[model samples]
Target chain A: MNSTKGEKIFYGINYFVLLLIGLTCVLPLVHVLAMSFSDKHAIASGAVSLWPVNFDSSGYSALFDETPIFKAFRNSLIITVVGTALNVLFTVLAAYPLSKRYFIGRRFYSLAVVFTMLFTAGLIPNYLLLKSLGLLNSYGALWLPGLVSVWNLMILRSFFEGLPEELEEAARIDGSSEWRLLSQIILPLSGPVIAAISLFYGVTHWNAFMNVLIYINDTNRQNLTVLVQQLIQNQSFMQEMANTQPEMAAKLTPEGVKAAGVIVMTLPMLVLYPFLQKYFVKGAMIGAVKG
Target chain B: MSKALPPPASAITNPSQEQARTRSNWLVRKYGKRVLKQNVPLYLMFLPIMIFFLVFKYYPMTGLVIAFKKYSFLKGIWGSPSAGLHSFQMIFNNDQMIKIIWNTFKLSGLSILIGFPLPIILALLLNEVRKMIFKRFIQTFVYLPHFLNWVIVGGIVVTVFSQNETGVINHVVKWLTGSTFPFLYNETSWTSIFIASGVWKEAGWSAIIYLAALTTIDQSLYEAASIDGANKWQQTIRITIPAIMPTVIIMLILKIGHLMELGFDQVFVLQNDAVSNVAEVISTFMYKIGIQQANFSLATAMGLFESIVGLVLVLTANSIARRFGQGLW
Candidate 1:
């Protein structure tokens, strides 16, 4: 385990390069975070540097008070919780039977999932379908296509296969049926995989704006991501229309507010990251590496 | 209604235990009962997902007919007349059709080719680092940009590459040479900025998978190669790269499946009228043309075409992977 002079030099160079690359990723976030805290006047005057200069809580206060930003927060929570529930439920149900190597019609069922993954009907068909089902502006629309994420199903399926058959066999011998065995025995051992899928679904649902934009046009049903988008939309449109708060409107920098919204929107997930990441990446790699 | 109209349930409905026995028999006869009866909890677990997909995914899948029809807001889906492929032609005649298709190919292909492999290379380098803390630091830092919102990333890109004299890229250009490079405006440079920014944001996070694959690359092989006097370069080229090749190939095959996707959120936020010609990718185009303009039929046709192409590419890629003995399945 000894390094020669050349090996040591090479190692030193490699570390420096990685350090530089790492800095590049971290620094921009610092810039945005700093900007989010800086006062509107200072931000507009270009006084804000990499760190905030002339710091103020006005932007944060205004964001929380004047806007439906909090309402959006509540909406995002609903969609994420409900959507993640659906995602995990459907993915596990579909994946469980399909994961069984001996399950009848397994290939056909799996092929159906694969078919959905490969070929989508696209926006128009999906939109019309939602309209026909009268799902427009409903919470269900937010979680529809998202339910049964094909990737999650695949990951959970892989996790299920990794479980030893003997565990299920023991339950079967006690007169428990396959359904009970999966629930009481199999699913109990699936904590990590479940956590990982739940996090994945949660993030996707939390970050979802496009589907909401397409399906639910009503402002009342808009989620946080869509609401942030509305802030962006308002900033651009405010000058054209009369500013709601004419006094503050002149000094309002959409740049900082938009930056604040990004932080607000992604911060919850960021906090959730360390807690779930150990499982999320492992679940992902289990499928990515092994498959 | 039956209970209201008929005599109370106390009459004859379920008064007899024999009636209950017959009802149980009927239920058993109607549906083959007790097949994995214990797994009802598992079925219960899947209930929400099944309902959601049934409503959202499968229903939308069946709703694909809107692509083939002149979707009338009044007449509704069933009453609408099918276009007999004319909607596809309307999409083709949009004048910007070729540009949209070209941008999609360029963006997706670039992201797939260079963006795809850089992660593997970075992973290989990091895997060889040997220092645990350093490896973790590299991972934590690089993975961050991937989690960042595209809006923030787009702002950062604009700030650095602003077309103005004080812009960072402009400043660098004026100082080093003599003129400004229109990073956003110039069509030729737009694709590179988009793809490079994409790579910067994702390369580290993406590399995590390759790194995972590398971890499984039997450590004994490396020990054997080192004992034979293989240098770091030789060992990486001969053993490590080959070990991770299957994962790399399988990832490549999957990337092929998403050839038409073009990262809608990223493109939608980053693009502007200045760079519209080059930056107007299919996904963004669909949003504008379909959603914004409300030309439902044309947009649907375009969306349908993209999906078909994507589907065909994925099928072909999966088959090829199957042939080569590698795929996610």
Candidate 2:
């Protein structure tokens, strides 16, 4: 074969391998999605295939009907929004100065940040500290601890370093102060890195459950991830198996409901992915390296 | 000291520019004394973050004392009676303590051992594909699981392997051999399920860094190998693997440092009465014995113990990396 045809043959094989890998990643998701929409009887009987059988919106309808789920969703939104805002604000301010090699205390600050990353203060200290601060049973418990991420800070710092000196120099010529230059010049030009970091911060905030579970006891204050865990625990969807057919009330397995719960929480991220897919892979890689 | 901060560029050429920068440097060098005298507004923006870190991040260090105390909320951390070494003894004395430690090491260490190499392999496999559309599609699919909450991952696992007619794995086995296999209900399959689920969720997302590293490799090496009649596998093993070895080692050291936390989210979800003995990691153990039981002192003690062990592992990993000429420091 000629070079082009030979390359074509190789490309075809690569595509086939990649396609199979993609399916391996995707099939499980489809399987769950299919089951979640199926009627409880259809699911319990294993009548469903790769798609929903007897197509029922009962799972979703019942989910929306519950007051706690909606309230939890609201709590999650609040935490994600406020937490991400704080995260972006603190991480950027902290990282900007750290990126400047000429800045005083740079080494000390880097040491402190990296030390925290490598050695987590352990769960007890963190919990006790929060309890002592009277932040227990509060949403502030979630937002405050995660206000600035060392990993994200390092990435933002690297981006700040890569900025052209001439831009800042030009701003300085016009009598712009450091703060002014950062806000007006550096930030405006650093949109990609900012967006990349923001997406990461947002996702982390949205998906966070463990800290909320530890710090907040009030069900009203719990975030979506916590709420979802609660819902799955109650095995509420398993009721569908018992509800429609009394014969299977005892047989109502947790399998389908768990799948539905995973599908429910995972839906938000999966829905958000397509919109932000391009940046995520790039952001992950860029953030992986040190500043 | 009272003079303006000099611009770096003008100082490159103009003597007057050099003079202004010197004046700025002197002002800063004076312990910010001159700058404070000039402007105090700079303090406002940084105050919140400093306080946040101090109160939430650093203040927690005080709780480390509970590790040394017969902790009581009534008497408080300082006033709490000092058992000193007793709680440490309690943990060490527990019949299952060694087993817990061993289980933790097995899960985390083996996860690291197996998990570290797969991403590089996936990335290499991915990089060989020249088609941009196909590459992007595969990446998007893989990265989706990384964003999921562990609660959801656990739920997914249960859904896949639940001992029921509707469970995915059981259904398939029932179809194939006319009998269902109860994967989740069986304790023997729990750890494997945990690790496999972990791999399934993370493999694609984790490959991004390796893919990035692969991009920076010299393409000309591949070209030369191709011309010499070497196939893609040979070029990949000979060239791609060596090129990304630094990133791999650094990532490995990072993974090794985290040899204590087998991801609380993953374990907390997968854990139950049947498999809690095997799956009860340090985090889960703390959550149960300390947090749920509300034994603040004992919890703090266990937390401190875990931290010490984790610290030692990380320090060891860092030092070993240094010895390997691939240390993160």
Candidate 3:
């Protein structure tokens, strides 16, 4: 609690450096926000920095009018919601059985699961396998392959294992099935872990990119990540957008539209940012402590 | 994915063994049948997961045989003819492949060199902060980019570093120096931007683990050290660093394990036509060759090589860590 003069200087430098670092992290996003809201002419003239020069919502209006950003948003939502539900379900089913001390061949099963994390089939084989299964170009391609995340399953397994065994014994004495015991007793006590794992899966699904790029052939099926990436990377896509909305071509710039697309794609994360920070730190701590 | 270590194997006596030891039919019927009946639901619960692993994970692993085969789409995985080591031979013979592999190693090595230690330093610095509100604000901002997918981050990077008037940095540079620098277009600058952006994105998120490690440290140790006339610097070096060395080592080992996988999405998004020479890595190369061009055999061979090297690296790193008495297993 006591600070020397040297300690005081160190603290001063520390705060200044940290404040600078924090600003570096946030100022770019702020810049993009400003660019997204700035007039096309102002953005073209490079007048925008951390604040908008001529505040306008026309970039977003143009983005919505010309691009399939709304479709991408809906697809992202479906994948995140449905994928997280399946993730939680499969994670629970697998974790419950593995948690039991008396379960047969549990070590073999756990090792089988964990080994996948160590070395995977990589992209080509996984893609080929998906192709063979007729899962390509469908949302099933996205969800089915990563149905039960090994990491989440491991966390949930530990959580389930840590639950009071007396509850299970008590349920067994009353002729409750293992299913009923898991649903009624184990899950009710695992709200925190489940919530954390859901957020984990939810974020992954929301950010789904490479898989969508590989498996989903239909542009209509693409999620916001891929769609935003298209708008950013593909100059031709911007050209196509301009052609689609020729009336607004003079009023729209690629920079403004791209920045708007970035914001739109990130809007959900921005909304969820507070909850994400709280739970994700908790989730990381749980994994580290129990890992 | 999951970092949860396997729990110590339970040594409960097997009910089947007990049933075998008993000569009486009644005991066998009671113990064996009841055990089987009770566990039926559990086995049932585990069945679908097993199927998923078999079909999606294990089956694809087996399908890696295409790496050694002349794969044909119509002929399928099973119908393809064996090419033995031809695909791997092609990989070694190709100059571009060599460059890509080197690029993968160089990028990842540079990333680890630059990106690895910052989080530890950031964590230590954050630990010294006296103001909770200030600490929270810094953390919130720093962790913001991690929540964003690479697409958004990549878009921001491109926008900020673009060569033209829209680029914020270039605009500032142009005003100051009367010339705009090519941050993304030039190879040297692109590499710098790549590594810097990676640090910017992940350094804060990675610090959380170190902060968590720091929390378990005893305050009395610091109190006693300060009472003994040790300065804050001396306290950190003598007390805090030693305290978190195991964590540092473990994190280092895990990081080394992922040396081969530089992550495709970030590179794919950040890379431009002008800088692809330095930017192309194994994953992106595989995407172009295998997925886009349908050169399945060659791409699979490359993928197989990456996976094997990664597995070897992890094992080697773990073994090295074991010598320091900090095996991940």
Candidate 4:
């Protein structure tokens, strides 16, 4: 596999261009991290960019002191954990039966699921539905409406269809019922697809804010995303806080606190991203191609 | 549901038509009962998902009737008075309608034009890379932004493009031109910023599909092209491009189908009062009118309009794709 001089030059240029594009993605994140650690006075003075200037931990400390922020963080955690579990359970149950060739009304059930991907009830009806159900302002408001994602269902169904039918037949011959076959035989063989879909559901739940904003009026029930959005968008909130607590203003500038909030909210995803990268790529490719 | 059940097996197998007619009735009943009894477990496993979809998805579809009604909270959806296209008329006659529609089209059109091609080009470039680790590293970095929600990205956008001296782009512009640009507020700059951020956020993730498509391309084609004295650029243009054309067309059709959406989260977070003229899109507008103002009918009307346009676009695009031999179905 010897390459020509021209091919060598093309490869060189490709490497350089890709490295530059990669940095464009990373630098802004680095800048945010730098600003989050910089002193409030230095941040206000517009000195920080790529690195911390007059470094301090006041912003982080201030965020830690805010009970509402912790509550929001806990809320996001609960929603993500419980929500992802429900999503995985529903998706597996639906996909397994639908994937079976002998399952009655498989086509009808699949079409019903796939229809939701193309069309939605929009926001108002969804909100009204939750409100009428007395689920608003509760944890159910966060995850109940989205208990089963159609896109995930399609992906999981495709994965299940790809599995060997002989394995299921063997389990059935061993007197395993449909439920036992799914739990004891099929599920254990479905680790990769399940992991990938679980990550998708987890990320969606963790990053959900629109549903929270519409349904949860109570502050304690809100997620980190909504809190971070409010903190970043409402610069006036910091000013109002300064007016009320003059001394506290010196320790936390709006920009510094906002950068801190962004970091805290985004850190979990970033940490989990590396470990999940391969599964994410595999799952996404499976989805894009088959979907 | 009963109508969906298959006819009796004896109906198809019977040799004598006259005898078949008489026996079919009894066989149909027996077959239906037998099938039901046999597949009960499968249906039981499927019941929860069916119930979920019925409650959340189909139920809300029925609620679309609110678009035609006054939508009083006191008098529920059924009890509300029929408005008879009042909301539709209100939306069409509104002064902001033209600007909102124009802005939505402009933003989505520009995004499709620019955002669609970058991923293909990036995938092509990455394909040219000889080293696997370097290619993987580039992909890892690029795919990072796709995982982040708009709120965090919006925060970063605000930080980088703020009018204040602390804003990174403004800081550099001030140093270079002795003046600062209002990236978020001005119409032209705001739209550019929106598209630019969109490209930044999705270009890497979108490239994954193209890259996957690229892998399916036979290496023999490239070797054949090379033997024909086709250079890298020529092979790319002639062979590589054609190999992935079906995928490219399918993705483009899907993107066009979602033209009206414009991503509610991205647009909502990036939008501000100052840039409302260029920034207000159909989804955000619907949210404001429907949720914020409690003008349920108008909001629902707007949503219905958006959905109808979306359905028409997808159907048209899918049909067009089929005509070109690359239909999604």
RMSD of each: 8.5, 7.5, 6.4, 4.7
Q: Roughly what TM-score does model 2 have, to 2 decimal places?
A: 0.89
Candidate 2 per-residue lDDT, tens place, A44-132, comes to 88777688888876666555653367788788889888989889998888877776655655687678777777666678788877787
Model 4 segments more than 4 A misplaced: B1-38
- Complex DockQ per candidate: 0.34, 0.50, 0.75, 0.70
Error of 3 at B11 (Å): 29
lDDT of 3 by residue, B1-329 (tens): 67987665543545666655664566446557667677789999999999999998998998899999999988998899999999999999999899999999999999999999999999999999999999999999998888888999899999999889889889999999999998898999999999998999999999988998999999999889988999888999999999988889888888888999999999999998999999999999999999999999999999999999999999999999899898988
The best candidate by lDDT is 3
Question: Please, what are the lDDT tens digits per residue for candidate 1 over residues A111-175?
Answer: 76667777877887777776767888898777766667778888888888889988777877898
* Model 2: colliding residue pairs: none
Could you give the TM-score of chain B for each candidate, in order? 0.87, 0.85, 0.89, 0.89
Predictions ranked by lDDT, top down? 3, 4, 2, 1
Model 4, residue B1: distance off in Å is 35
The residue-level lDDT of candidate 3 at B16 comes to 68
Q: Where does candidate 3 stray beyond 4 Å? A: A241-244, B1-37
lDDT of 2 by residue, B65-114 (tens): 88888878788878988887887788788878667777788888777777
TM-score of 3: 0.93
Scored against the native two-chain complex, candidate 2 gets a DockQ of 0.50
Question: Model 2: residues >4 Å from true position, as ranges?
Answer: A1-14, A236-258, B1-44
The deviation in Å at residue A112 for candidate 4 is 2.1
